[model samples]
Target: MTVQPIVFFPDQRLRQVAAPVVAFDKSLHDLSIDLLDTLRAAPGIGITGPHIGINLRVVVLDLPTSDAPEFYVNPEITWLSDDKVQNEEGSISMPEISAPVERPTSIKIRYADLHGNIHEGEAAGLRSVCLQHEIDQLNGIFWLQRLSSLRRNRLIARYKKLGHA
Candidate 1:
């Protein structure tokens, strides 16, 4: 697997909503592997197809202490708890900045495995945060968009000063 180049923020493709993966084939499997490799190389806990310019509803997550990475194909949040928590979220596309974003404390999600098998699961804490973050990417919402206007503007200015934005 190759560690594909990530598409940075402000790229038009990052704003485009990802298309759902329709075929469960070797290409899908290869994309999953490439995503995992790219995530590891980015040294991030999670990544999605859009990060590497592949606009498909795919996400690869390697939460801390997990035995292996998890791949979600065409993931969708089916339910979210009213209870919310604030967590610091970042993205590989915009590596230099992170801000606290409020999200559901727990969520029920439906997604398919690489083999096209459907699964539903509940996630909480960091796992839930990561999933929500990546799903937002799949839906064309960059993590920075989660921040408030003041915070987002400040972060963008900081990013620009750092020569990354």
Candidate 2:
């Protein structure tokens, strides 16, 4: 698998909802692999299929503590805790820009592996933030939508200044 080009932020593809991954086949597996390569090339911890314009509910995350990237297909949040935490978040598509985003501090999610085996898990802290962010991408909710209007506008201006708008 090879690293594919990212779809870049402000690209409408990033805002379009992804279709559920239906076939647990070679193409899906390859796309997941390519996603990992692309995420590593982008040097980001997490990325979704929409980041590369695939429009499928897939995500890859390479946390600093892990030796390999984790893949999630058609992941859905099952439960969200009342507790909230704010962390500086950015996207592979939107390089050189990040803003503090507040999200549920803990979450329970259900997703499928490449083999189509469904699994449920709970995450907290950084993992929680990453999952929520990527799932939102799958749901057509950009991280900018999680920010205040003023903050979102400022970051957008900065991105434009970076010549990416």
Candidate 3:
């Protein structure tokens, strides 16, 4: 496992649509490990392939106090609840400001594991938020995008002032 550099906002690669894994190869497993390593080292709850400019549909995450991490490959939302909870969220890619964004408290996700095994998981609370956030990154969307226009503008201004955008 190796720590990979995270790409910041406005990077073209972050907006690139990622390619899905055709085979569960050793390279994909290694990449997941690296992403987990980077996420842990950065002290972040999650990280995506696009965040590292890999343009691959992969994401890794662990809850705030969880020691066990989970990896998702080609993850997609299978179902979502209409019930939403607004949580203050931040990202390693943009550390300047955290804003409240509403997301489902529970979600169903389907993905292939490192071993080429397909699985489905139900996530609620922080796990749900983390899943949605990372999946958004795969779709070229950021958590900040969930904020209201005014808040998003304010955040961008703050990030610009901090020289992080």
C-alpha-based local distance difference test score of model 3:
0.86
Q: lDDT winner among the candidates? A: 2
lDDT of 2 by residue, 89-110 (tens): 9998899999899999999999
**Residue range 1-165, candidate 1, lDDT tens digits:** 899999988897888899999999999999999999999999899999999999999999999968999999999999999999999888889887888899999999999999999999999999999999999999999888877889999999988898996
The model with the greater TM-score, 2 or 3, is: 2
Which residue pairs clash within candidate 3?
Answer: none
Alpha carbon lDDT of residue 90, candidate 2?
A: 93
- Number of the candidate with higher lDDT, 2 or 3: 2
Q: TM-scores of the models, in the given order?
A: 0.98, 0.98, 0.94
Write down the worst ten-residue block by lDDT for model 2: 60-69
How many Å off is the CA of 116 in candidate 1? 0.3
What ranking emerges by lDDT with the best candidate at the front? Answer: 2, 1, 3
lDDT of each: 0.92, 0.94, 0.86
Model 3: residues >4 Å from true position, as ranges?
none
Compared with the true structure, model 2 gives a TM-score of 0.98
In candidate 2, how many Å is residue 46 off? 0.5
